[model samples]
Target: MTDAIADAKRAMRAELRERRHLLSDHARETAEAGIQAQLDALIAERDVRSMSCFLSTTTEPGTRKFVTDAVARGIRVLLPVTRNDGLLDWAVATTDGDISEGLFGLPEPVGELLGPIAVNDVDLLVIPAAAVDASGMRLGWGRGFFDKTLGSMERCPPVYAVVYDSEVVDEVPREVHDQRVTGVVTPTRTLTLAPTRR
Candidate 1:
């Protein structure tokens, strides 16, 4: 059963990733703008002082503008630095200028390393995902980095996954170790999920 679920999730990831890659630059920019607007509203509503977010890839929902703007607002922002063991280390991303390519071809900050547990210090957490179901189950990349990190948190703050609007679905293949998100932020809207059967 585990293997079948993994395989199904693998196929879903590929399809979602391919769809993201096919988005045009103009479409992505427009989506980013919409996402940024929703993000700003959420941040203010929640009074988020610090957050851990991912440095989005070109094909992913763009987060550069959001990160830059957050930094400018004096909101502390941390980006993940993938480690050799598949766990992630955190680092300050005070600005958008110091990012560089890191493990798994993802962008990361060059600031002082804050170790893995630094994620616990944030008031909010913004995770990257290929898709998220209406019940708040997130479908991340095959790697278990975010899953492990979230599982390790003692008092996890509100966690939100960033994805395109279409990626939000009614269901997603989930394993026992998979972590659930509190909400999902898309380019067009923010879905604050109500509790559902797990």
Candidate 2:
């Protein structure tokens, strides 16, 4: 990545993080509810029998409620476990699954680890992103875990990034390794971007 692109990404991520930190409690609650509804609707629309999702960090758009509800509905949900080698392992989500802080202090499942390939079986993927642009390019947090996962997949399912409504911007910095998502889910709406992957 060029220095200019890297610097741009850092600035964008910092600005977004600050915005999330400043969100009012009421705003957060409202956003969470909206996100849950949008996600539930997406699941139903896609007929997603199995899928992968991330446990939201406090400052990210909330997914815990959606995760719990999906498991309750008998959907096979897999939560990510960060691996030391810059890849992610998967774990089956349970309604009563234990959560513990993993690498980067992100919330992770405390269940039997399913290897990285476990994600290949999913019907869909909902991932975390600092921001996503109109053209579907996703700006992930500095780490490339999701990028690598998406890049390595032989046949990736539809991938969506969850962010606050404001984070869906006109454009964001992108690198060749940065993976684009099929759509984006925000507090107010879900948008399907033009598909760029084969």
What lDDT does each candidate get?
0.88, 0.94
Q: Model 2: per-residue lDDT, tens digit, 147-180?
A: 9999999998999999998999999999889889
Best by lDDT: 2
TM-scores for the candidates: 0.95, 0.98
TM-score winner among the candidates? 2
lDDT (C-alpha) at residue 167 in model 2: 91
Worst 10 residues of 2 by lDDT: 189-198
- Model 2 misplaced regions, further than 4 Å: none
